[model samples]
Target chain A: MIINHPLLGPRDAQEFTYLGDASLISRPDAQDDNAAEKFHDYLYLRDNPAGLHRELWFHESGDRSWLVVTRNTVTHEITDVQLARDVARKEGRSK
Target chain B: MRYSGFKVIKEALTGHKGWTPQWRDPEPQSHYDFVIIGGGGHGLATAYYLAKEFGESRIAVLEKGWIGGGNVGRNTTIIRSNYLLDGNEPFYEFSLKLWEGLEQDFNYNAMVSQRGILNLVHTDAQRDAARRRGNAMILNGSDAELLDVEGVRKLYPFLNFDNARFPIKGGLLHRRGGTVRHDAVAWGYARGADMRGVDIIQNCEVTGFKIEDGTCLGVETTRGYIGAGKVGVSVAGSSSRVMEKAGMRLPMESHVLQAFVSEGLKPVLPGVITYGAGHFYCSQSDKGGLVFGGDIDGYNSYAQRGNMPVIEDVAEGGISLIPALGRVRLLRAWGGIMDMSMDGSPIIDKTHIDGLYFNGGWCYGGFKATPAAGWCFAHLLKTDTPHDTATAYRFDRFRTGHMIDEKGQGAQPNLH
Candidate 1:
């Protein structure tokens, strides 16, 4: 059901992450500090790399606000991150 | 006998063996206190309320087929009171309150669940709309919350979080909305009203009404002529057909609304989830089957069968929400025609006829609003005064421009 477009890579199960359940927003227990940010939004990886050549590549995080995440596609190492608008403009793609 | 909860215990100790009638002859009574047509939820509810309010027991609820066999039973059993418009919010809130206590009132297990309903937003604009709706719920004294993408992931882990087409941006969480047993709702009201000495004459379709001067004097059913002082038309989908008999035409279109069920699973979804971007919504029934429905057919048709386009749209939306549903085979699909009105809100007011009343134009919210609709329609029947919330849902609102345009697209049948 996770159909990755031609521009996007196929969904890999290993890349998925479980931040928490989907009901924290409705619960009064989530009103405390950091729960709104850490537990409010859920994150999941759509891929599980099968190759040995580990390359750290950055991609948009598929949210409304564009994100630039630097992570190993194979070894899954986090190296760099920023908003796509901030990082891409610095790289002279602001035509 | 006073009306109480659902269970009824007969008492012989107080000379109160219920009302002993003269069993008057079936002769056209010439004038009845009240006559309600269309024995669906609305009509029956109206009768029950009328008796309770006005001490008027001379009410007859007429039906064409077996009572409760209409859209009352065919609806996809979902209930929610979270509305965004002005006129709709209060009416639905009344309905939600009735649903919460329906089991105790009807003495029948309606299987009403507060399993919650999630409207998943996929874009910034959709998130804004969801936020507005959530705020509207709060303003109307209903519980609602705005959920972010992370909030959605934490709750529904099975969704495709990475898919750009329907990325989990956020959602509007209505904690009180859920599903109910559709048929039990009809049966409970029927048995309860029947116990109250309301004569339920089924299989007697009203072919025509006897009009005297400008007032509806009586009804001419297939069985025979029946006299009544007041008549209420609570037919949902058949509003056009029945109204045409009175020389009145409605701004209504008839189309089938279909629901699909998948093979029983281990109950993956705990509540109903509606795709804000697509016409897909689903909830797990008590029997572990996934009961879901989507948009109505754009064209007018009486056929209860649907085509492939809506099926594909709903399936794709379902798969987007829960990736695991792709493995579950769809058990079946069926349809019911909706009485979609021009303004999307319902019309529960007196017609131009002096003695005739109407309660139609519920659109998709018919099932959820059945109880409150009955209550209000009954109030109108007894006092001839409109409820404060439903005053603007009149037939004249279409021309006066006082429309309750819920979708904000003006008067159109496809208000989804």
Candidate 2:
């Protein structure tokens, strides 16, 4: 599989290590009242969709950056890619 | 017709005209006492046990595709009980025991071959770990034998014992562990269940669950709405998608694992062999094809096809262990998706919704757990309590701090 990285253009999937759903970036707040339950859901449960999915891939063998790759799980087609830092800022998790 | 020597002789005498279809293709009924989604090995086995053992009638195994069209027909066909953990060893050993008498119980020729499975040990630490695991298997009432370098060489003289990087130090062998004809298992169970008055409905995709006031009344399928007293799902990698229609997310991800078969050759592989340093296992089929597989592609995918990197890695592992495999030409390869649970173990328990039970998250090891998974799932659906051997396979295990993480890789589904 080839992942068209936002910065690196097209790269082989082997150059990146998969870390699964991009939703993992917004981990549950540990200070919530039902923190344990929320964290359990956050850590264990997943919206494992069969269609288009957004996931994280670490550029371990490349530039040592993280990317959010929106790809179709059914077809393995890359629809979009963005730096995870940019995605974190967009999701209000980064400055 | 009863299959026997007399039956075979009679059919031969009559030009083989007396053979009938093993199972019936009946239309979907409006209601059934129990509806099992996924007509793969586990679902069919569950229906068979529910009818034959649990004395339940009006059972129907609903499959979106035909029986044996899923992972049941897409695995390496190796069966073993050589597990390490207290929570896992008992369950798999029970499954292995069931596999011992499965053909006899189902009255079908599944070709249950007990050739053996040898897991190589490449280092001193691996030997110690294998020794501990062998002892654990023995303690759990399963057979396990630790063999030194010479012992392994005696069994298979062609291994790379003197490889500079990953020399073979020893191996752990489970004598009762071997291969069964993968597709025949599904056929036998479907036939047995059909004979016991359970409907095996294929081409009936479940689109949604009819949950009314927290009680699952039935399922909405492509065929139509079919009511059920209880609903049990064993849909392998499709578990998350199916459960999502019922408004539930799973503690799981789907990944594709590819299996390969090589050109037919003379009897080469005497038994199953696994590389200790890499994620590759191989067994020779009855037809002499070398059947093999490696790790799943480490990403979520519903696509039933694998990428080149994993295939290359598997080939590298196979050549590293058995260099002769490098000469053998591969005939075919196919991928099967697995529902990888966080703890690398399966979950078989009741969901929050009443009358809705689940059995999935088998990772890539579901084929080996077929019989016990069925029996325990049947027990759960009938009694509303976890089976004795499957008490640890609960959905609440993750929340209650009791994950049966055999690999010790924590909550990383792909890593497991």
Candidate 3:
């Protein structure tokens, strides 16, 4: 399950594509007043943690970008990866 | 106690000493009107249908580990309804008719085998999606045949049938689907919820919940704070870490999924087959071994253990469909987190907290929805509603877009 890809330096989490919980790119504000309960808790809540987490993968076989790794759902231990649009423009989640 | 051939020849003439211990570990009880939490096999068949079909007195279940330890002993034990959606073909044809009388209503042999299930079909759009899932499993009454390719070459005549790459042109059978004995369906629903007095407990571990203002009222385990007037859970893949200790967050993900087996031989799988192009599936095991599984490990994991390129892409989809399963041998493998859902189908509803009730996203099909997900999660924890074959397993159906999906694969929980 390698996945070292910040720019495809170590690949192979079987060529990516598992988009889950990187707080889903912080998706909310669908025009807010509890915009339909914050877009139904940003499309059905998550935080499925079992230790470290972070998630969202997608290299889809190589440089199609997306990354964000972090890992460790009970010792699958990756530690860190990145490029989910540079962690969504370093968390400010730029448009 | 009634398991007999004159009680196995009077316990083989006495040395057997009146066997027992099949259930009854008891212990945890500060309160209970129905706790549940996950002794697997849909939390001991929802505490054996909330005390044998809703008479729901006291009850309990709990188990953080034990009663056939999870994924009802790690699936691959197929079972089918063929399914082509309508929120999952009448809830897996009412859990394949409660796996056909489940050992005469849990009297407990748990070998409910029905012996059938095929699927094969190679392409022409997977034989028009297995003839529209065998005409939606014969319009949901559940029995489907659609065979051909000389009927799976007369029941699998050593498959790989001229495999110039995925050849076997026809399948989709069902015949009351098959396989059981997965940890004897968690010891026959923990011996029919301990002869209906319920309370199985064991190893325990819940770790949180007991909410107050938002409502829940019970849990927090590892053996303590057990109060519950309602609770429920059915924790497969720890349903987003047990509903995140009650703050709640789940569309679901968890993953893992492995499975495998092999070693023993001779009988060669005449029952479950599956493989339409990839993610394998198999059967056999009445000791002849084979078993099998495929896919899932496409990342997120609660880690039961897997990842050897999904065991070499499930032994290349079981040697491209039984090329004599590359001469057997493998013997063991495991894993089974799965919760999955976002539209793989399964939720079993009600959890705005008030007395909490959940069931779970049985992706990778929770051991063929164990007895109609414990008879519709014991009719939604004793009648809060939703049992007309799980009324589309609602938990707001992904906020009412109503996503039953049945592998149309959107909202990708690893592509369903």
Q: Which candidate tops lDDT?
A: 2
State the C-alpha lDDT per candidate.
0.72, 0.94, 0.82
Please, what are the lDDT tens digits per residue for candidate 2 over residues A21-62? 999999888999999999998899999999999999999999
The alpha-carbon lDDT assigned to residue B62 of candidate 2 equals: 97
Candidates sorted by DockQ, best first: 2, 3, 1
Candidate 2 docking class:
high
Query: Candidate 3 recovers what fraction of true contacts?
Result: 0.77
Work out the TM-score per prediction: 0.75, 0.99, 0.36
Give the local distance difference test score of model 3. 0.82
Best by TM-score: 2
Point out where model 1 deviates above 4 Å: A1-95, B1-31
Q: Tens digits of per-residue lDDT for model 1 on B1-416?
A: 33443213444444556644322213234456788999888887787767765567888888888878988888888899889987889888888998998888867778899999998888899988888888888888888999998988888888777787667788889989999998888877776676666777887889998887889988999878888888889988778778878877666655568889888888688988987767888889899899988887543445556556678878887787778888899998987877777667889999899888899988877999988999999888888999876777787776556878888765546444
* Candidate DockQ scores, in order: 0.01, 0.92, 0.29
Candidate 2 lDDT tens digits, B1-416:
66888999999999999999999999989999999999999999999999988999899999998999999999999899999998899999999999999988999999999999999999999999999999999999999999999999999999889999999999999999999999999999999999999999999999999999999999999999999999999999999999999999999999998999999999988999999999999999999999999999889998999898999999999999999989999999899999999999999999999999999999999999999999999999999998889999999999999999999999998898
